[model samples]
Target chain A: MHIEVVANIGEARSDDLLHKTVIVVDVLRATSTIITALANGCKAIVPVETVMKAKEQVQEGDLLGGERYCKKIPGFDFGNSPLEYTREAVQGKRIILTTTNGTRGIQKSMKADHILAGALLNGRACAQAAIALKKDTVILCAGTQDVFSFEDGICAGLILEELTYTLGEKNVLINDFGLAMRGSYLHSKDRLFETLVSCANGKKMSRSGFHDDLILCAKSNIMDQVPIWEHDQMILLPRSLARSTF
Target chain B: MHIEVVANIGEARSDDLLHKTVIVVDVLRATSTIITALANGCKAIVPVETVMKAKEQVQEGDLLGGERYCKKIPGFDFGNSPLEYTREAVQGKRIILTTTNGTRGIQKSMKADHILAGALLNGRACAQAAIALKKDTVILCAGTQDVFSFEDGICAGLILEELTYTLGEKNVLINDFGLAMRGSYLHSKDRLFETLVSCANGKKMSRSGFHDDLILCAKSNIMDQVPIWEHDQMILLPRSLARSTF
Candidate 1:
């Protein structure tokens, strides 16, 4: 199957994603945070476009997790940093999350037949799940602040590289942005951590005193669960769950 | 100066380009066509967003040049191939152009203080003109059919590479998309011609019998002229004219 990449959230529309397997990458923290929440036993994650919508969606017991411009909203239970998603904090609870860029991508991609939350943390699982879905795919990179961001592009390339490695014999066509991203990833895969740390978003996060979050995002495939989207909610799916899933 | 790359026309609005210098790349043909028209002694080029507007703008001597889907539109004098713009045909004539994607990008970028039509044909010249203007720049890639195209991204990266080589110490910050593009260019620059012929757009053009257009587009620095936008029209700027252009 062919793979098309929407380089930023701006290029994606709900209609275009319909009937396709869409993998959303926001590597700086949003998807990473989701994976962390899932691995730590969070029940389910609901991603909304804005903080107000996030607040409205949260139930009495469900925690609100999100950030606006990288700062935690005044009353939210957590910011977007993955390091803050401790088992004691999120375990066995549901979370309604929003972030500056990533949530916007998820909100726009809700129409996809299958939506996968992908990050460097659970990249392998995400890749395999996408391949297992066996449909035309779209990799949507949620750029920082409505503009292109390097960290997300690197993660997108990593995913494409993974897919190419496992499914090389398949007929796949990566659009230009996808090709460029894969090229960037191949060039920096050896120094993935340092490269992410030096990219524009990485520097912004570091300067904003979020070095730990950067470290957490740079760790490759540390988590094995793939966060799969069904009916607008994302929950980590094991191979068994995804295989049985449509 | 910061380098922001709007990967496709969909991501751009004229207001965002206001007071900034915008470099537009449509390597598969539109910008390449503009560069060829200017290089062949065309007096001026007016880029319009629609076929109806192009028809209205064309006078008896003013040629209509553009494409709809890699084929020449009915009644248009040209089909966006650089080879069609021979000195004998385009010399001293004015051309009104409209294409599916490139013209849209130009219309969206009109508010910029400086708008340049750039492509692989005159990549070095376009990059030099951007530096000479000394303004915050955005590389607007006119993607194929409102989606990312590899040839345009490669051309954008080539211009960025040219700028980096000549102005190595300048205060430059390339956005993530720009970095990824530059990386792709470095990887494929050695195989420039072969790579272009093998790219998605190139294959489409070749299959449609536009292989000659691809060859014309692959040559670098064929002409030293840069097409600079001013007063709602594009004029080929010589070094002497540009030096005094304010």
Candidate 2:
């Protein structure tokens, strides 16, 4: 299997993503929030590129969830925080989500054969989901404003590490960027929270009072569910179906 | 002290580099060769972006050196290999040099306050030179064909680690990409040659009979000299002058 880890959405070519499984990672909030919502029983997440599109996609029963610049969109149920995506708040509801980078990444990967939302919370599960899909993979780190972000790169490293572990090192062929990310992940795995805290977004979010979010997103493999794109919405990959495909 | 580690030439913005000290790294050979040539008593290296420019710049006593697709240009004096630039061949002689990526990187960084050639062999010296220049630094990894390469990224990491060690962590402010590279460098410092051999360019160079070059380029901080852009060419920074700036 071949894995190419793109540094940011700006560097990702849609043509390269074609016929491949693209894992979109936004650990500073987007993908992490998606994974959290799904794991906490959100029915589905419709990720759109713009706030207006997210509003248009919403139906009577659906919840509008997203952020613009790390703040909750006006009249939306929540910001881009996993902690806000509790079982009591999101259970059995569909969410129309739009954020700065993560949703834009998913939109850019529309041509991919499979689009899986990946974060540290579900890194191993995302790797397994890609394996089950049986396509060359592209891990797109949804960096901030087209610049590479440490949290997303770290999440990409976690998924690449998981893929290498499950597929065996010899069976996996990773691009140089992925290889660097894997090394970065291995070096910082022991102090993930501290690592996240040291990055730009981490410091921004911490100053903005999202310290708990950093702690939540820094934990690896805490959730076994993977959110996969299907029919214009992201839903959990059925556990039994994923296992049987292995 | 602020530092930005750009993944490739394509991603570097000229405005961000203005007034900053830029260290251009191409560890698969470009900067490494330049460092070796200067350390071996080469007078100066004029880095150009094209074969025609290299030829045009050559004087009566100048040596023409460059590579096209990892092979020596048909009639050049040497290829992009440090070993080929022996003291007997390059002593007190100017060289007109061009390569696929590294020269392009230096060309792109013309707006910077100072531009220095950096590779694993001279990473520490390059870091010290940047400190002596007393400007915010940008480590531009001259990746292959606008994509990130492991060797260059590792060299950037090595330099970042050196800067952090000398300046102290609290005083040195690094961007997220630089942080990732520093982590990667720390992780693979013990087995750099193996790490390089596993990367794409490394594998290509090894298969093309440049195995020795890989071994030579993988050694960290082997050279105590740095090549800085002065006037229109790259020359060794005077050790006394650099020390005096400190």
RMSD (Å) per prediction: 4.0, 1.8
Candidate 1: pairs in clash: none
lDDT of each: 0.82, 0.92
RMSD of 1: 4.0
State the TM-score for model 1.
0.85
Q: C-alpha displacement of A50 in model 2, angstroms?
A: 3.5
Backbone Cα, N, C clashes tallied per candidate: 0, 0
**Runs off by more than 4 Å, candidate 2:** A244-246, B244-246
List TM-scores for all candidates, in order: 0.85, 0.97
Binned by DockQ into CAPRI classes (incorrect, acceptable, medium, high), candidate 1 is acceptable
Q: Largest lDDT belongs to which candidate?
A: 2
Instruction: Give residue B4's error in model 1 in angstroms.
Output: 2.2
Per residue, candidate 2 scores C-alpha lDDT tens digits across A87-189 of 9999999999887688789889999999999999889888888898899999999999898999898999999998898899999999999999999999999
* Pairs clashing within candidate 2: none
Q: What would you estimate as the lDDT of candidate 1?
A: 0.82
